[model samples]
Target chain A: MIKFSWEFHAAIENYKRMKRIVEFYVEGFTNLPDWARSVWFIILLKLLIMFVIFKLFFFQNKLKKEFSNDEDRANYVIEQITIP
Target chain B: MFESVDLSLVNWSRAQFALTAMYHWIFVPLTLGLGFIIAFMETIYVKTGNPEWKRITKFWMKLFGINFAIGVATGIILEFEFGTNWSNYSWFVGDIFGAPLAIEGIMAFFMESTFVAVMFFGWGKVSKKFHLMSTWLTAIGANLSAVWILVANAWMQDPRGMKFNPDTARNEMVNFWEVFLSPSAVTKFLHTSTSGFVLASVFVVGVSAWFILKRREILFAKRSMVVAATFGAVASVMLIASGDSSAREMAHTQPMKFAAMEALYEGKTNAPLVAIGLIGDPQDDPMDSTAHEDFRLKIEIPNMLSYMAFLKVDAFVPGIKDLILGNKERGIMSYKEKIVRGYEAQQTLVAYKKAKKEKSADEAVLRAKFDDPQWIDNYFKYFGYGSYYDPDPLQLEKNAFTMIPPISLTFYAFHIMVILGGHFFMLFLAILWLLFKNKLENNRIVLWTAVWTIPLVYIASEAGWIVAEVGRQPWVIQDLMTTSKAVSQIDTSSVMLTFFLFAFTFTALLIAEIKILTKQIKIGPKKEGRKQ
Candidate 1:
C-alpha cells in the first residue's frame, strides 16, 4: 500500500512537469518576435501543405487501404515478391 | 499479377525524393556545424566576460534559429515518402530500418528541442553556466540525430545483421549492434558530419569577408574569422582522413560503384588513377561492346588506384566490363549467374509458401533452405536480382550491363568534390595566415575569393551527395532490393502532381530563408541602446 502510494505521487509529479514544458513552448511560440513570426508562418504553412494537401489527396499506404488485414497484405506482398 | 510496373512512376518517385533530400540537406549541414561554432563563441564570451563576444554569439544564434525553424518538417516528409512511394521497401525492411529512425525522433530530437528552447529563450532568465551548458547540449543533440540517420543510410549501402523471414515476407533484425556499428556506418557518419563542419566554416569565413570588404564591424569580422578558420582547418584535415576511409570502405563494399567513379573498363593489376579525364559516351547498341565508353584525354598517377583501393600497388582492380562480363580467374561471378541463383531462391520461397498454405510436407524441406546459412549465402543474398532474369540470351546480356550505374555522372561528381575539397583546405589556411598578419583587410584577391567560395562550397557538398546516391542506382538496398521492386503501386500522374507541389513549397521556403538572413545581415548587430 505504501509503494503504490509513492508510485502514484511520482506519476502526478511527472504529469505536472510535462504540462509546464508544453505550456512554456506554447507561450514562446505565441510571443515570438516579428522576424521569427515570419519563420513560424513558413513552418506551419509547410506542415499544412504536406499533411493536408499532398498526403490527403495523393499519398496513401496502398496495401493498408486495399487489403483489410495482415494476412491479406502478406499474401499480396508475397505475390509481388515472388512474381517479379 | 505483378508483371509490369509503370516506369514513369518509378522515375517520378525517384525525382521527387531526390529533390526533397537535396533541399533538406542544404539546411541540415549548416545546423550541424554552425551549432558547434555558436557554442564555441558562447564559451569564449563566458570566459572573457566581454559583451562584444556576447553580441557576436547572439547574432550567429539568431541566424541558427532561422535555419533551424525553416529546416523543420523537410526531413519528416522524407519519412512519409518511404511509406507513400516505396511501400514494398518499407514492408520488407521496416523492421530493421524503422528502429534507428524511431530513436532519432524520440531521443535525439527530444534532447535537441528541449535544450534548444532553453538556449534560445533562457538568456536572461537562466543562470550563465546553465545557458552555456544548454548551448553545448544543443550542438551535441543535433549531431546525435545525424548519427542515427546516417547509420540507417549506411545499412542500405552495406546491409548486414538481418534475416529475411519467408513467413512474414520481410526482413527482421537479428542483431542490433552489428547493424549500428558496421564499418560503413562509422565511416559515413564521420565523413558526412566533418563535411558539414567544413561547410559551416566556409560559410562563416565568407560572410566575414563580406563585412571586411564593406569596412563594417572590422574587429568583429576578424574575430569570427580567427575561430572559423582554425576550426575549419582542423575539420578540413579530418575531412581528408575520413574521406580516405570512406573510399576504402566503398571499394570493399561497392566495387561496381568504385569502378564507375573511375570510369574503369577492364580488370587489371597495377591500375593507374585517372587524375583528370574526359569520357566518351556509350553507343546506343548494347552489344556493340568495345569498351562501352573510353577516356578521351587523361592524366594518370601510376599504380595509385590499386594502392588507394586495396593498399597494394599491384592488387587487381576490376572495372565496369570485367564486373559485367565476370572475371573467372578473379572468382567474380557474372550477373547472369547471379540472376539464375536468385531465380532459384525465389522459386523455392514461392514453393515453400504454397506448401505451407496447403499443409504439405514439402513445406518443411523447402523452408529449411532459408534457415540454412550456406543456402542463403549462395542464393538468397541475390534474391532481388532475380527480377531481371529472362530466358532470351540477348536480353540476359543487356540486363547485365544495366547493373552498371551512369559512369559520367558518378565520375564527374566525385572529381568535382575532391577538387573543391582541396581548394577549401587551402582557402582556410590562407585566411588564417592573413588574419594573423592583420593583412586581411587590404587583400582584395583573397577576400573576394573567400566571398565567391561560399556558393562553391555548397556545390561541393551537394556533389558529394550525388556521388553517394547516384552511384548506388538500380538498387534501393544493395543486391537485396532494386528500385523498381521497391516502388509503390501508385498512379504516375499523382506522383507527378505532388512532385511539383513539393518543389514549389521548398523553393518558396528557400527564398524566404535567404531574404530574412540578408535583411538581418544588413541591419547588423544591435547597437548599445538600439532595439534589434
Candidate 2:
C-alpha cells in the first residue's frame, strides 16, 4: 500500500475544522461596533458623491443614448474619429 | 545608440501598442473572471428563490458592465493598431492570423453582446431559468473570446500549422485545426484564464473584506467571501499547475526566452533556478557579455530549473551564452550564422521580385532557387535576423545575439510572479481556514490583508505578461519576424503624438472606472425583500 504524508492529511483536517468554525462566526457580523458602522457611512457618502460627479460630468455616451439606429451610431463614431 | 537609424518610429510603435495592450489587459482579466462570479450568484438566487442572492448578483453585475465597456473600448483600438501601426506584420501573417480574430468577432462576440443585455435588463422581464441561462452564456462568451485571442497570440510565439510563401510574401496556414489545437495555445489559454479567475476572486474577496472591516452589508460581505475563497482555492491551484506546464512549453519551443527568464547564460546539466536576489543592470555585460554572468547577487535553487524544464534531476539545459556562442557538440548554431543566412534569404527575395517585375529571362530560375525546400527552410528559420539595423552586415551579425531583450526585466518579473503565486496559496489557505472557523469578521488582520491584495494581484498579473512577452526578446513572431521589421512605415512623430493621445484618454477613463467601481462596492448589495 502506498503511504501518503501524515502532515498533508492533518493539515487538510485542520483547515476543514477552521472553515467549519468560521462558517457560523460570520453570521455574528450584522451587529457591529459603532466605529465600524460609522466608517461604512463615511465610505458610502464619499462613493455617492463621486458617483454623482461621474454621472453628471464624465462618460456621457451621447451616441448610444441619442441614436436609435445602428447606422447613425456608426456614423457618429466614424465622424468623430475622422473629424480634425 | 540612437544615431544612424529610424529608431523613433520603432520605439513609438512599440510604446503605442504596449500602452493599448496593457490597458486592455487590465479590463479583460476582470471581465473574464467576474462574469462567472455574477452568473454563479444569479444561478444560486434562481435556485433558492432568494432575493438576497439576486441583490449580490446585481451589485457585481454593475461593476462587470463598467469593466466590460472599457475592455471593449480598448480592444477596438488594439485591432485597429494592428492594421495601422503594424501593417507589414498584418500582411506578413494576415492569412494565418486573421482567421481566429474573425472567428472571435463572429462566434464569441455576438453571443456575449446578445446575452449580456438579457443578463442585465431581464431580471423581471424573463423567466428565472432563462435569466440564469443568459448569465451563464454571457460568461461562456467572454471566455470564448479569450480563447481566440490567446490562440492568435500563441501562433506568434509558436508559429505552427503555417509555411512561409516567398511568392506571395506571406505565411499561409497549412492546417487550421492544428493551429487551433496548438499545445502552446492551450496552455496559454488555460494559464491566462486561470489567472484571470484568480484576479477576479481576489478582487471579490478584497472588496468583501473591506465591507466586513467597515461592518457594512454584513450578510452580503460574509457570503461573498465564502464564495470567493472557495472558488479561488480551486483556481489558484490550477493557476500554478498551468503555469508549470506553460513554462515547460516555453522551454521546449522558445529555449532562448526560457533562458532569459531564468537569467541563465551558460548551458549546464545541474542548472539552478534563481528564486530570489537582484541582478546587475541589463546593459552591464560583465564578464562574458552574458546575462547569467552579470549576476551580482542571487539565491538559487540547485538543479531546480533543470528539473522544471526537463523533469529530470540532472538534465542539460542551455543558457543564453551557449545559444549565443554556438555549441557544436549540442548542434546549436549561433545567431551570427542566422543573421547571415537571413540576409541571404532577403537578398534572394529582392532579386526574385526585381526579376519578376522586369520579366527577365532568369526569373523562373531565380524563383526556383528561392523556393528550394532546404534553402527556404533555413531562410524562414533565420528570417528575424534580417531585421537587424547595422549598416555593415558583418557587424550586425556579430552583435545580433547581444540584443536578446533586457534580461533584468525578464528575471525580476518572473521572480515577482512566483512570489505572488506563493502569496496567493497562503492567502487562499488562510481565507478558507477563517471561513471554516466562522471567524471572518473577528480577524481584523486577515480581513485587511485580503482587502489590500487587490492591487498586488493586478501587479502579479502584469508581471506574468512581462515574463511571457518581454522574455521573448527581439522576435515578435518567434524566429520568423523581429519587432523592428514588423512595424509600419509611418513617421515617428505621428505615432508618438497618437500614443500620448491614447495615454491621456485611457487614463481619464481609468480614473472614472475606479471611481464608479468603488462607489458601487461602497453601496454594496441592496436590501432584499426576501430572506435566505
Candidate 3:
C-alpha cells in the first residue's frame, strides 16, 4: 500500500511537469511578435522542401537503398575500400 | 582501378557539399559573436538598471534570433548531407566523428534551444535575474556548439586517436580526449570562434554607424559602438595570435596545405613570405624548380614564412615540388613512394580478409601486421594514396601531380583573408579612438568606412573558410581518405537536382532574413516610453 501510494504521487508530479512544458511552448508560440510569423513561414517552407522534396525524392541514403541488411552494406563498403 | 566510376558523380557531390557548408557558415559566425555582445548589453542593463541599455540589448537580440533560426535550419541540412552524399565516409569515420555532433545536439544545442525560448519570451513573464542568466547561458551554449564541430573538422585536417578495424572496415576511436584536445583542434577552435567575434563586432559597428550617418539616435549609436569596438579589439588581437598558431600547426600536420597557401614551389631554408604578388599560371609540371620566378610582380617579407612556420628563421620548409617529388635529404617521402606503400597496405588488408574467411594459417600473421604500431604508422597511414596508384610510370607521375591543390585559389584566398584581418584590427582601434574624442559623427569618411566594412567583413570571413577548405583539397581526412574516394556511389543527376533545390531554398530564405531584418531595423527600437 505504501509503495502504491508513493508511485501514485510520482506519476501525478510527472504529469504536472509535462503540462508545464507544453504550456510554456504553446504560450511562446502564441505570443510571438508580428515579424516572427513571416520568419516561421520561411522556416517551415524550407523544412518542407528539404525533407519532402529533396530528401524523399532525391537524397535517399545509398547504402540503405541498395542493401536491406547491415551485413550486405558492410560487405559492399569493404569491397569498395579494398578492391582498388 | 575504380576509375570506371563516373567522375562527374564525385565532382557534383563535392560541389553540393561545399555549397551547403559555405551557406551554413554565413549565419553561424554572426550567431557566435552577437550572442555574447547581446549578453554584455543585457548585463549592463541589469547592473545599471538603465532602460536605454535594455533597448539596445533587445534590438541586437532581435537580430540574433533571426540569424540563430536560419543557422539551425542550414546546420541540420549540413549534417544530413553526410549520410546522403558521403555515406562511405559517414560509415568509415562515423565512430570518431559522430560523438561530438551527438553531444552538440543532446547537450549544447538542446540547452541553447531551451534557454533561447526563455531569453526571447521570458521578458515580462520571468524574473530579471533569471532572464539575464538565460541570455548568458544561451551565448555560452551557442559557442559550445561550435567547439564540437570544429573539433570534428580538425580531426579531418589532422586525424588522430583512431584506428581502423579490418573486420568492420571503419576507423574507431581509441582515445576520445586525444581527439578533443588535439593541437589542431585547439588552434582551429580558437582561431575560428575569435574570427566570429571579430565578424560580429564589425556587424554591430556597421549597423551603429548607419544610425549615426542618418543623424538619428546619436547616443544609442555611440553606446553600441563602444561595446562592439571594445569587444572587437580584444577578439581581433586574439584572432591574430590564434591564426599564427593555426599556421604553425598547419605547417606541422598539413605541410602540403601549408605550402599551397603560400604558393611556394621550391623547398628552401629561410623562405620569404609573399606579402603580395600576382601568380602566373601553374607550370606544366610542379617539379620545375624555375617556376618560382613566374610571378608577374612580387613583394615579400624576408625569412618570415620560415620563422612563422617553425619559430626559427633557418628551418627548412618543403614546397610543392619537394612534397610531390622526393626530398631525400629532408626525409620527405614523395607521392609516388607513398602510393606504392599505400597499395601494399590495401593489398595486405585484402589478403587478411581472404585468409580470415578461409580460416587459413596466414590469417594470424596478416592480422598481426595491422596490430603492429610501426606497420600502422609507416604503411597504413598512407592508405588513401592507394587510390592514385597506377602501374604505368608516366600515369604515376601524372597522378602525383594531381595531389597539388588549386594553388591559385588557395594563395589568393589566404592573402585576402590576412589583409582583411589586418584592416579590421586597425579599423576597430581607429573607431574607438575617434569615438573617445567625440569626433566620430563629424568624420563622414570614418562613418562611411564603418558602414561599408559590414560587407567586407563577410567577404573576409568567407575567404578565411575558402583558404582552410580549398587549401586542403584531395583530402577528406588527411592521409586516410581522399575526397573522391569518400563520396557516395550515387548518380550525378540526383546530386545535381538536390544541389539546385538547396540553392534555391537557401537563397530564398536568405532574402527573407534580409528583408525581415531591414524592416525591423528601419522601424527601429520601440520608443522609450513603450513596453518591450
The best candidate in terms of DockQ:
1
Model 3, global lDDT? 0.87
- Share of native interface contacts recovered by each model: 0.50, 0.00, 0.37
For residues B1-532, could you state the per-residue lDDT of candidate 2 as single tens digits?
A: 6564445788788888888788878888988898988888887888898888888888788778767754564665666667667755776785677888888888665898778767755656578998899999999899998898899999999988887665656678889888989989999999999899889989989998998899898788878877877778889899988999998899898888898888787888978888887877655432244334667788989999989999996988888877766789878877767766776666666666667779998789877865577877877567667555356755664466555766878888989988997887688889889888888789999988998899999999999988888888677898777776677656677677678867886686677678767866776665654221
**What is the alpha-carbon lDDT of model 2 when measured against the actual structure?**
0.76
Candidate 1 wrong stretches, greater than 4 Å: A1-31, B1-7, B285-288, B528-531
Interface RMSD of each: 1.7, 14.5, 2.0
Residue lDDT tens for model 2, A1-84: 124677788889999988854643443235433323443454354344334543334323343446687445433332221111
Relative to the real complex, the DockQ score for model 3 comes to: 0.49
lDDT of 1 by residue, B128-236 (tens): 8999999999998999999998999999999999998888888889989999999999999999999999999998899889999999998998888888889899999
- Using Cα atoms, each model's DockQ against the true complex is 0.52, 0.02, 0.49
Question: Higher-DockQ candidate among 1 and 2?
Answer: 1
lDDT by residue (tens digit), candidate 3, B1-532: 7775454988888888888888888899999999999999999999999999998999899889988876676877777788888988887896788999888878665889889999987887788899999999999998998899899999999999988887777889999989999999999999999999999999999999999999988898899999999999999999999999999999999998999999888898999999998998666643433446468878999999999999999999999888888899999999899988888898888888889889999999999998899999889999988888899977887788888887888999999899999988888999999998989989989889998998899889899989889899899999888888788887788888888878887787788778888888777777654543
Candidate 1 retains true contacts at a fraction of: 0.50
Candidate 2, superposed: residue stretches over 4 Å from native: A1-84, B1-7, B285-292, B368-373, B389-397, B529-532
TM-scores, one per candidate: 0.94, 0.82, 0.95
Q: How many residue pairs clash in each candidate?
A: 0, 13, 0
2 versus 3: better TM-score goes to: 3
